[model samples]
Target chain A: MTQVAQAMRDKTAVCGVGLTLGNFQDKSALALSVEAYDLALEDAGLERKDVDGLIQLSFGNDYDRFLEAVGTDVRYAYQGWSHGRFIAPMLQQAAMVVASGMAKAVAIVHGRRRRAFGQLADTEMWRQGLGPHGESPAYGAMGPVFGAAIAAQRYFHMYGGSGDDLAPIAMAFRKHAQLNPLACRTSPMTREDYLNSRWIVEPLRLFDCCQNNDGGACLIITSAERARDCKKPPVYISGMQGVHAGPQFHNLTLPGLGVAQQEVFNYRPQKEDLYAYQMAGVTQKDIDFLITYDAFSPLVLFGLERFGFCGPGEAKDFIKDGRIELGGELPINTSGGLLSEGHVVGWNLFIEAIRQLRHECGPRQVKDAEVCQYGSFLGETVIFRR
Target chain B: MEPSYKVVEEKTGRYLPVIYPEELPFWEGARKHEIILQRCNSCAKSWYPIGPACPHCFSMSFKWDRMSGRGTLHNYVVFHKPWTKWFESKVPYAVVQIQLEEGPRLTTNFLDCAVKDIKIGMPVEAVFEDITSDITLVQFRPGKK
Candidate 1:
């Protein structure tokens, strides 16, 4: 696709955003979902009666309470998971519902506690038993971070980079958290802290992962035309795409040194074309800010490079420059990403993106910010727009 | 430090059993220091790591085909840390996922080489390393070897 083809043209705008109190553990996912809905309704200067549509993470919260909190009968509703792919697409669906006059307005929300349900919803083994094949026969059980760690281990041996190469990713996001008040700020994590942190799944350390907080977040979605009467300056849904080839065994491979069925990043930007390095027409430099879905630190490395922020394997260097910090080259997770900000599944991720574009941040706000980007768990939907 | 990798049975070979009939050939082959996979008889489907039925067809019938163990590197990642306490000494080792010439992907440890020498889509072959009396793992080495 040409650079012009990737340009942002206003489509739909986010009108209101709200986040529930992030808890270490307390209250169910459903309660948090309701709190966020009510707060978002209040934030937009609208009433519960205004939300006629709803979109939520299929794996996370309770839906009946979500419907009750919105005080709407629910004209349009959706729930699914291919990880983060569902986030932006669900918002797009809510936009279509409003645009088609099926509903006047929609509130999308979700929440979860990592300790309660393993946070990432990695239930591969739970489903393994029903299958007649009897997969558990082998010692190789499919856990969430199992494959990712195994792949990372191989990458380190191939690249000769230390585990410390991943530490900067964790420290960078945590450092971004200090300025974010709503973000979980206990201690400033250092690369040494990340290295010294307790191990969870093999190569991944506790500090290298994100907080699985007990919380919910909400975002009000409406068309660009209707948003003028609702709330917040609308950032259009410029270019959005979701792709799922298959499971990891069939799809993924390692970094520059590995092999796989397909070239991993089909949409990855290239340097020679300058513009080719972006997933679409715009470069990372164009966006005022972005949120890297940091469930695990290495993922941020992949996200940084994948989003065309920096060249392949250059995230370590990009991070060292403190560019993702406030007032740096580009600000990230001004709401303190999943790492420090707390992981409310991908629900909080949605609200953070809207909050940044609305310029509502006090200390973490990017100066003269216009365009913004947001992603879900697996980055099925990485929104790019103004 | 010496490079190594091992699996803790957790409970036992009973609770966390490693009994796979489709792997009769791979295991039997391993006893002889050979690596193989089950190819579906009815559908001509090649399955790695072994399975009871062909995902394509419900056929329980398959033949154990020995691999020449030669193929270009499909994709890989070098892990700077081990997945378990057993691999503590093996902090830096490559767990490669290679697409073999016989048309099936295999995940094995890469060794006998430096990290920088590995390249994308590079050729590699299997070299058996026995851990126990009857168990042998198929480790990948540079194909030219």
Candidate 2:
């Protein structure tokens, strides 16, 4: 059997990545977005005028506002949102736009003031608008942690996993955070702290949740040819894909009463990651480091297993012994991840991947790094070369 | 005849399920202590949280039918922390997902058991909790063998 490759693979490259000021609150989400955009332009050695396209999630400042602030003549713009908490979908969209010749360079940006305005679910403005409207919310499944807890519980039941199994992941990220100056949680966390922390939902402790902080991130994507002329080394978008659990029902799906399946729950993302690998023309062994959408700590465990980094239920063992840490077999989340670096959705994971491939991460850099795999709700695989 | 529902403050302070026109029959059935769902006429597939189209076959033609309300508890979570003002008193309560006999999983609370003792794959049955004059929430408990 032959495998057809991803059409847009290596057609576009990420030339610039920028982030706004960290946890310190001062700027509005819009202001932070503009700041990140300016920084990204500077990093790419391109001016506002060089940006012919803009791609952003709705949470960011308006494209017209961004163009007015930067004074760039934008030829194309798109507002995208992906299922679940994935931010890489917009990056994939930007790459396609650039590859199609509709735009020379596209900037994808995301900004959120979740801190200043209070938590998204707690704020009256969002509460009234968003409401606990979903089916699960009707049954007291209001916060993301609740549903995530259920998923974690199911994983534990199926794979002989326990809260103790996730201890190493939390500790590893905390250690990684210690090395990251931009991290929100810099203080070291002991195993006792992880276990003793109050449970938000059983099997999920305080440290399992990602922090809510004020921040924004932007990435600049352009044709592979144009990226070569940029100031920073380009991290090409080799292969990227997003996969949802096939249907709305069952354990693998979100906590909603949409459908039911009789089969044993077998939810894994390895097949999707394998498809991405084939598209990138690389094997799993070629990946030097990886980053996961660590909106919640347990997700890192799921990402590891689902991405085929290890066999089912082996992720708990695979991630131990400094394996996922720097200088280990496959260093992961070199930027400290959302667990420590503050949640900018999954955008930080992509930026961290670029930084690693560019050899910009001085202390947390994975040695001799080339291929970097990123797993979100969907999986994206990119291989970088100097 | 039994009252359609009983008015009470939602324990979790979350919005009660807003019954749209398409879901009126399901709620109407809940009031009668029966589990009703949408069955696609074309594929004979049943679904919960009633909607207009069949998710399996995309068939618009369907009928609301009563389910036996028997299922196995597929998974569950016990909330040790309350997210809203309403659920503070209900802290440490459990929400269970029951894979029903008719091939649909419904999200509801566990009844007649301590949250700590509920186990996965346990056979369960649906029960109703009347929330408002027109809203009755379906919940689950250990099935009587």
Which candidate number maximizes TM-score? 2
What docking grade applies to model 1?
Answer: incorrect
Q: Which stretches of candidate 1 lie over 4 Å from their true place?
A: A1-8, A60-65, A68-71, A100-102, A117-122, A126-142, A153-160, A199-203, A244-282, A375-379, A382-386, B1-103, B107-145
Docking class of predicted structure 2: acceptable
Model 1 lDDT, residue B29, Cα: 78
lDDT for position B55 in model 1: 57
Q: What is the lDDT of residue A131 in candidate 2?
A: 26
* Candidate 2 structure, TM-score to reference: 0.89
lDDT of 1 by residue, B17-136 (tens): 233443556766765867777778999877554667765677998777777878866644444544445455655555566788877776666778786676657889888776555566
lDDT of 1: 0.60
For residues A237-303, could you state the per-residue lDDT of candidate 1 as single tens digits?
6555443333332211223423233234323444532332254456556778777666666666656
Chain B alone, candidate 2, TM-score of 0.87
lDDT of 2 at A348: 75
Question: How do the candidates score on chain B by TM-score?
Answer: 0.79, 0.87
The candidate maximizing lDDT is 2
